[model samples]
Target chain A: MTPQPTAASSPRPVLYSFYRSSCAWRVRLALNLKNIPFDTRPINLLAEQNKTPEYKAIQPFGAVPAFLEANSQGPALVESVAILEYLDETRPELPLLPKDPASRAKVRALVEAIAMDIQPIGSMRILKYIGKDKEAEWTSHFLKEGFSALEKMLEKTAGKYSFGDSVTMADLLLVPQFYNGIRFNIDMSAYPIMSRINSELETIPAFQASHPTKQPDCPPELR
Target chain B: MTPQPTAASSPRPVLYSFYRSSCAWRVRLALNLKNIPFDTRPINLLAEQNKTPEYKAIQPFGAVPAFLEANSQGPALVESVAILEYLDETRPELPLLPKDPASRAKVRALVEAIAMDIQPIGSMRILKYIGKDKEAEWTSHFLKEGFSALEKMLEKTAGKYSFGDSVTMADLLLVPQFYNGIRFNIDMSAYPIMSRINSELETIPAFQASHPTKQPDCPPELR
Candidate 1:
């Protein structure tokens, strides 16, 4: 059965997450920023736990960061940005999206730049497809290409945070991507605008607490 | 300067588009579906025209489907889905997003399935990165995998179009991706729900009018 279109509501939301999954991290950051308390159902991608049938029930795509609310019984939502948008629309308090339509569009454009263009290259499936020895090379090439482009966009939209300082959803996607860049050893300093925003974001407790190393499944050594 | 986040406003919006770019096609479909009149500034991706400095002034990332409204002067919105969302918010007459939060999330989920996971694989840059000899193998591998997973999601949400009877944004995204699948020779019949939806959508004037083959820049042979 397809997961029902249940937005965030009642009880607590459950996030089926993996520690290092950047997509999952985006949702975690959104949840934290909204100050919405949530339970984390750790799915260890390194262990391939996401591929199992039980996990598949929640996310047919078998990806990390599937979310369920209201019933929590079934019908979880897949895709990070979808879950992010749901929380913003339902919660209303933290207001991850800006009020004006134009600002909102700019925020979303930044969100997609990372979510669609950058994050996919470093995705587990894509990285695996890229294969062992050359994975980093493949990721670096694409990440840098995307980052360079995003830096240009950020230069226009950024003001303390992506799309101004209020900490919109764009920042949620950006921080995790920056974190991944650190992991891949991409020269973070090269993109001054993104680096500045990421640095500013790191200081926030929500961003810090929601980090990959802080997740339930994050191994202690990495933590 | 960053493109102003001015939502779609006064003056007929101008869409910087290319005939065959699936990303651009998504915006064209949104405009058509909303019955919003628009002007198309053709950016020929095949001719490498998107690389020109004139285009870069509007879209620093230098992609097609950059959008400008209000003054028709500056600060265009880049990213197809962002442009789609902008129009939905501004032109509420057609109502591209569903009402309830959950349904909206579901629609966005299907959108991301194609936008993030599927569409990027068939993108010009990715295919070019894969190089000529292996581009087909690479694209077909990811598209089929994504379609297989998306088909599972559709079984639950689809009614007439994706996310029930309404022609939501998901249909806008799905139509173009399905078209690209045809280009790659991916088997459409394997995903019955998607195939049915695509067939139904083709019967709609908006979808038909927005076809890549019908765009101004489309060559006669392709048309």
Candidate 2:
């Protein structure tokens, strides 16, 4: 995939991200799906480069996926979900949210279920809290619990995509979270519907280009 | 506030919530603010009401603030952010998200910053993970860090509310998270902007009525 300029006559929107971070991946998927031109500045999260003074000036949180809207009035945005929504709004050719309100809510719920509930439980720092040996058990427990709700909800709202096939913002969120589940070795078999949607999503250029293994900063071992 | 008939209108939207849970409080605020009528069935977390067979069937995760969509095609939606977005969508008279995408993203990010970053670190379970002795320190650290970001964000976004002069979804989210900060005995002096926003929000019927202290199930000590 060729990198495109974010601005017509100026530099592209710059995304500071780590390849493996699910949150960052969410933004990447959104940018790709919208065909928005962006430049990727891979932050060395593993190397503690995010904590440096220069990086801290842009993002106090020191989290990956901070976005710099070169021409936006406000300071650069730091959170991933915020960046995704902003991109969707600023460029709406292929929108992330559904046109209808109820559908939009369902999509947001699906996205938040993973981002808020499942992702945090399986976070690296939390694993460090319980030690690695127990991390497996912890991750498994949350995934099983979260996936069941997701599967049930999908059955309720899904058609071709997460919400009646439009491939709204929920799909962007679902793919990376599924990747997280796979990373933690959580069983996906129990979520056949989720797996099917993810399988469908993987073939799309947006998801394909956004896969962590495909990113410029992806580790050689993972690649 | 009188309850509004849910979409289906067969039965009122049944809110399965716990008294002290911040997620539950978010929904309460939305319901009250929207003037939607609903009956609340308290699920005592301490007594494990959520883990009951019937409750677990509705909420696989056994968390509070599960909304049984009275008439929607979808199943009971979980997650506070999702629920609030749903309410805002189905009842669009008083909008929760802003008109512009950039503004909406800003609001969602503010909500997520609290829900994803601050709320998770200080959750009852996380406290358990850090052990009782260190829990206070852990909670205080995250609250202050989150408040610092929130203060900056609110300063940028605040007019009369968290994201503008309008009472947006971010204000609804900000209230409960701020309550958590107060609960943990975190000093609010540094977060003057957030403190002011919270004070202003407290005067509104939406936020005032939803205070957890007013709930029937709220413990006297906690209340």
Candidate 3:
């Protein structure tokens, strides 16, 4: 499909992202799948770049994966899921959400299961507050609890991708979170459904390119 | 405006909700605002009713505010934000989201700011992990940080309600999160915009009726 036309005067879409941010990777995956070319401005989370006043002005929460539109209107869409929805709306070539309201709702529920339920639960700030000693346990506890339930929901929904054959918004959320599971040494064997889906997604170019190791800011050894 | 009628054979819409849960209260507010009649099945979180296997079947995440649609599709919409979207799409009488895409994106961003950033930060589960002695301090810190950033975003969006004079999805999220701030004794004076918008929302019937104190499951002391 031919991509949508941009106003010449408009700025190219820019993503303010962190290399290791699952939220940032979600946006990266969606952008790659949609075949929309955008520039990535890396905000280093580990070094606390997001905490700076400038970054906070961009995203009030000082979180990464904030998207600037081709026309760049309103507040920079700060939330990852919201940015996915925005891109899916404006760029409509490869629609991330299903057309049917019921299907869309289900996909969005899966989106939230990862985005809201799982991802936020393991926020670096929240994990740090829990203290360094138990960070591994704390992350594992939330991830396992969230993934087990998500695997059950995926049983009803997964065909090839997270929703059907198509790469809907759910898959965009799933891949980065699965990467998180890897970081925390989650028992992926327990979640056969997620494991199968992740394996299938690993072959996809968008999923592969959006991997944390491939990002511009990823450390050399990690890359 | 009259609400849409469901198919005669299909069951009435049901919302598994717990009163004081901010997440559940969000769906309650949306249902009320949309003027849809849904039977509330109270799953008391404090008593661990949500942890039961039966409730888990309905909501794989074991969270309250799972919505069973009139037609009941593949999966029950388990997240409050997604449930709000479902109700708005299914019953169009009261549009919880704006028609324009940009505005809708902004509204959803506000939704996530509350749903993802603020509400989940204070999950009773997470707070319990943080320990009881510092619970108030922990909740207060996250709430203040989240609300302060959100207040800035509200400046760009708020008119009479969260988005404009008419109530949208953002208000549903705001009212519940604001109630949570009260529980945590968050210093509200810093967020004049949120306080003002919240004050306006308090006068709305939907917002008032969905209060945590009004639900059947709420204990007498809370009511």
Evaluated with DockQ, which candidate comes out highest? 1
Candidate 1 per-residue lDDT, tens place, B1-223, comes to 6544433454778888998888999999988888878888888888889887767666666778898875655578889898889999988988888899888998999999999988887789888888999988998899999999888889888999888998999998898899889899988999999999999999999999999888888999989
- Model 2 Cα lDDT, one tens digit per residue, A1-223: 1122233222577788889888899998988888878888888887988877667556656777777775553356767877877887778788889787666777887888778877876776556666777877777876777788778668767877898878988888889888888888988887988999999988887788889998889988988
As for TM-score, the candidate ahead, 1 or 3, is 1
lDDT of 1 at B76: 83
Error of 3 at A113 (Å): 0.6
Candidate 2 lDDT over residue span B34-145, tens digit each: 9988778799988888777666656656778888766553356677887887787678999988887767877887888888877876776556556888877777766787
Give the per-residue lDDT of model 1 (tens digit) for A1-223. 5444434454778888888888889899988888889888888888889898777766777898888885565578788898989998888998999998888999999999888888887888888888989987898899899999899888888898998778999998898899889889999999999998888999999988998888888889988
lDDT of 2 at B166: 86
Poorly placed runs, candidate 1 (over 4 Å): A1-11, B1-10
Model 3, span B1-223: residue lDDT tens? 1122232323668788888888888888887877788888788888899888777766778888877776554245678787778788778887888888778888989998888988888988788777999898889888998999898778778898889888888988888888789878987878888899899989888888988788888889978
lDDT of 1: 0.86
Please rank every candidate by TM-score, starting with the best.
Answer: 1, 3, 2
Q: List the residue pairs that clash in candidate 3.
A: none
Which whole-number lDDT from 0 to 100 does residue A2 have in model 3?
19
